[model samples]
Target: MSIPSKEFTGRHMLMTTVAFFTVVIGVNVTMALYASSSWSGLVVENTYVASQEFNRKAAEAKTMAASGVVGKLSFLHGAIHYDIRNRDGSPAAVDEVAANFKRPVGDHEDFHVAFAKVSEGRFEATHRLTSGDWIVEIVSRRDGKVVMHEADRIDTGGSGQ
Candidate 1:
């Protein structure tokens, strides 16, 4: 005996079209929800105020750069360290070293740490970071004026160092 094959009909086409659109719409909704729940991408709270101070901030940054002061930031044994140096590779004089740690996507997990002097141009903080990406802004001040400001992106691997 021979077996008869099933025939393709309008009902099958309608079901196929509905399934395809359902899958597409489901994926799009999921992606949109994730995107909206993640980062807000806000650099500053008030853009107009920031714009007003832009020229003065730019001038200050230029002066800081011209001062030939640079800083190296590192993490070791769960401690945060910063080394400040002058153009001649000598230790730069800084009274206080403060670090602001922020996540790239969110304000949660953001923190501030003050560093103590370990030696000339070397400062260390006893805060441990969780293993992830971080944006660290190191600011060195002398006589209540910022002498060096550096921003860097760091990835702490599974070690959290």
Candidate 2:
């Protein structure tokens, strides 16, 4: 005897569609929540104010570049080191040095380190960093004015520029 074949119905199509959409929507919602929780979604508090300050900040950077005032940063073991110099290759004297070490994708591992002057134009601080991508920002200020501001990307396990 030949076996009877079952026919596909609208109910089957409906269930298939529902299952596909459910999976799609479920994944999307999961991704959205994860992203929102990990990042604050704001690079600055006020975009308008930051835009207005852009010109001034650029000018300051140019002035520092012209004077050859620059900062060099390095990371090894658990310590961060910096060296600031002027056009004449002399150590640039700054009142303070501070740095922010940020993970590229999350805030949970971000930290700030205050540098102590080790010698003329050199400073060092110990940080707790792991092996990964890091965004490093170093600011040198003299008399409450920024003398040098530099940013770089460094790999914790390798030498960073």
Candidate 3:
């Protein structure tokens, strides 16, 4: 028996379309991941807080939110005073930071953040944070790219500082 010419044409067309869609979807996904990784994206990081392990934090936050464990951060210049309020008039919050900075770095705990503390207009991360090259992405409720600062890495290992 011989295969019908129409059957061959229809199968070929369907396969071609499916292949096209697959490639398109793959590229879209890759681009999305890169953009999302950036500081500014769909889910903005207004105060330099990157939700690296969002799912994990979400689960934890959900549980803690009920317990009234609101996240807060503090920016410090000398690891003593709140530098966040020094320059900017706005008060900032430290959401979370690396608990164990001395330990090996992981995909998530890249750095820490303190969120939504409004002493003035500026915001801070966390006190005792694992100091070292932090990306201070400061956005504003008014607009984007308000200002950003990068702080030198410090030791939280309690090395007699």
Candidate 4:
């Protein structure tokens, strides 16, 4: 009875290396494609203009803070409630209040809703939002100028409030 010997060759090593690298390269390509297709990576249309605008907004926010104008915001029962007040806790009145809701991951679900003053310095809007992580931006405008601005992140998971 003759026993056949299985020999290890350079060809066999080369094939094994190629197979391993092929899978690694394939996975990397797949991940790259998915990341590129997920988002545009452009938060603003123009970077220079956005930077200038951001600086201006920062100045405005600083001026507002110095003037003792501030605000508090909350979300509940399919409504956005906000209270604008001064450093002394006196209610501050504004011409109009605008709220912008944006999902953290994508801009597809971004929406703007205007809040009406329910009471003195207290604004509320009935805009129903889905359960997820949301970036809430509230701006109180007076005479076509931003008087008070605030931004926050909220996760509606358990409180149900």
Q: Each model's C-alpha lDDT?
A: 0.88, 0.83, 0.41, 0.83
The TM-score of candidate 2 is 0.66
What's the best-to-worst order under TM-score?
1, 4, 2, 3
Residue pairs in clash, model 4: none
Q: Candidate 2 lDDT, tens digit per residue, 4-118?
A: 9998999999999999999999999999999877864336668999999999989877887888887888766668789998888899989799999887666898889899999
The alpha-carbon deviation from the true structure for residue 86 of candidate 2, after best TM-score superposition, in angstroms, is 1.3
TM-score of 3: 0.27
List, residue by residue over 68-96, the lDDT tens digit for candidate 1: 99899888888888999999999999899
Which residue runs does candidate 2 get wrong by more than 4 Å? 1-42, 158-161
Q: In candidate 4, what residue range of length 10 has the lowest lDDT sum?
A: 36-45
| Candidate with better TM-score, 2 vs 4 | 4
Top candidate on TM-score is 1
TM-score of each: 0.71, 0.66, 0.27, 0.68
Which of the numbered candidates is closest to the native, going by highest lDDT? 1
How well is each residue in 1-161 modelled by candidate 4, as lDDT tens digits?
99999888999999999999999999999999998788634366688899889878888778877989878887777787989998899988688999888887778888999988898789998877777777888889888987888777878775544
Query: In model 3, which runs have C-alpha deviations exceeding 4 angstroms?
Result: 1-8, 41-80, 83-161
Pitting candidate 3 against candidate 4, the one with the higher TM-score is 4
Candidate 2 accuracy as lDDT: 0.83
